[model samples]
Target chain A: MIENLRDAVVDLVYLVCAVVIILGLKRLSSPRTARSGNKLVAAGLLVAVGVTLLDPHIHWRPANIAVMLIGTVVGAAGSIYLARVVPMTAMPQMVALFNGMGGATAALVAVAEFQRFVASGAVTAGERVSVAFGTTVGSVAFTGSVIAFLKLQELMTGRPVRFPLQIPLNVAVVAGIVAMWAWLLGFAGSSASVWIMFGLALLFGILLVLPVGGADMPVVISVLNSMTGLAAAAAGFVLENQILVVAGALVGASGSLLTILMSRAMNRSLANVLFGAYRTRAAG
Target chain B: MNQEFLLGLYVLILTIFLGFEVISRVPTLLHTPLMSGTNAIHGIVLLGGILVAGTAENPLTLLLGFLGCLFGAGNLFGGIVVTDRMLEMFKKKEPAARQA
Candidate 1:
């Protein structure tokens, strides 16, 4: 009874934070509230983080505490460095890099959880499905986001990189990843298949973004952000964390809406952003 | 299907409409800044990474978690700072500067 009450209290904390986050997003409709909105979201995040760490299930051992402390210090330092020095012109790529970071974290969580289940020898098929979804989408978002960053930074030309068999190759890679994912979910909990699936996903992300011109990066970035959010949400399900699930879903929704706004601003459609079929008609 | 899933779904759907309706009203000139500002919110994953790390005992899992936290923090801070800087540009200039 006491344990149940504790769980309820923790969840209640998460609920409050979630509401604050939504209110933060809603406040973004005007520039006047935008700064405060950012602060509100940050405060919500603090609450969420505080409660998650406080959960009794986490067992914050010496090593765990050590690791988190060092990571936070390192993370804080890097963030400050980037925020201080990176010019506004390079902002898109910076944003892409950040989105990619979120994806990588989600992918790592999925991978770590799967490893745990495998060690216990109780990995279920349903769990495999969630792992497959999380790994595939998260991997794609990570690599796709990196490519976007490179393009925006002018490390690569902005024009769509095409090859003699671009479409055929992309289709083949997609099929290969899907097949591997199915195998992992349906056959057995083989690490080999999972690795192959992850590799194919990385390849797919590169191929997917390679054919899009630089002018379409805002939409690309937002779409990729949305996918990353969905991936995180899937990871949350696999981990059974209420806060992760809600926050990830919220990001997914907001990212999608932001993508739509971006596409409209560009006077292009979603299909056009993804396929570049309407490139000339829309831009010229 | 499950209770947890149902709860997540409800939040997801509600957010979809709320996000769409709210952002739809912003002017186009502010679109880029708006997107940049929201970018920091995704850093919530940093907390998730820390949770994973907290439960994980092994070095490898811990390493991955550490890296994840690092990246998420970088993303979060970079996003907020950049957004703040961009929004500053939109401030109404001194009328004297405009005339001059």
Candidate 2:
């Protein structure tokens, strides 16, 4: 019963963290409370991470420890130093880069799982579906986020880069990726095909985010955040990890809702975000 | 020492330091953007939650993960909306000041 009690404590901690997140979010809605709110949220995350480490099933393998160390150092350094050093004008681009990195990490994790499945020859249909979804979403988020970073940084033009037959080209690439995914599902061990599809989707992500202008960055950021959540959810499915799926779905849904709200704030429609078609008649 | 414990302690100290810095240098001009930028940082919570959830194999883990994502997303959206409103206010003030 001691183990049971431990589990209960962990659950309680998780619940408290969740509540903290809610309160933190509420406080963040106004400038007056933003600082405290940020602290609360960070505390919630800490609690969540702490409880996760208590799970007996979690193995502290060397690779895991190394990865965690690297992430911690890099994240701390970035937030402490780079965040302050960067100018305000570049904030949006920095956000884009971080969001993209999140997506890329999820995709890489999913790919690793797929490789394990292939090597073991124990792949199932459900696993295949999860792999395909994760790969596609992750690839899309990674590439799209990078393009967003470029546009915000002025490395690329903010104007939509529409070439002749642009729509057709995008459609064709999407189709090719989909077809490749289908083939991978059936073949069950075709790494090359999967990688190819990943490449194509990455290209699609870049193309998709490129044409969007600076004015729409807020909406784009929100939408891309949703994509990252969805990708994470896909990874959860692939890994058969409940927390991943649940967390991913929550992020995805909330992100979608936020995207809607942001679009509305700008007096634009969701359709506009999907099509990258909103053009402000009044130029700033 | 456990990695999680070390990380937690580090984050706690960092939080205290950053909090102090923010209070001392709370610029009126930066109020809006700072809030928005930090809100975007809250997006990282989603990343953390997902990573933790991806490690879970049980139903409870899934539920917690889902809830964490929801809360994080809410913060992100709410923060953006507030920032936009503030930006609008700033824009209006600029025009009025120009006229004066």
The candidate 1 chain A region of ten consecutive residues with least summed lDDT is: A275-284
Q: Write the per-residue lDDT of candidate 1 for residues A74-145, one digit (tens) a residue.
A: 876887687668886887787788788778777777777777778889677657876788788888989999
CAPRI rating of model 1: medium
Q: Which one is best on lDDT?
A: 1
Measured with C-alpha atoms, the lDDT of residue A22 in candidate 2 is 51
List TM-scores for all candidates, in order.
0.90, 0.68
Residue-level lDDT for B69 in candidate 1: 70
- Model 2 DockQ (Cα-based): 0.05
Relative to the true structure, candidate 1 has a C-alpha RMSD (angstroms) of 3.0
Fraction of native contacts, model 1: 0.58
Candidate 2, residues A1-284, lDDT tens digits: the string is 77688767765776576567556645544455655665676576556655755655443654444444444444444443544556656766655665666566556556556655676686776677767776788778778978887888888888777666777889899999888887987766476776787788888898787667777876787677767767766775665543345445545655555566567667888667656442432232
RMSD of each: 3.0, 11.1
Could you say which candidate leads in DockQ? Answer: 1
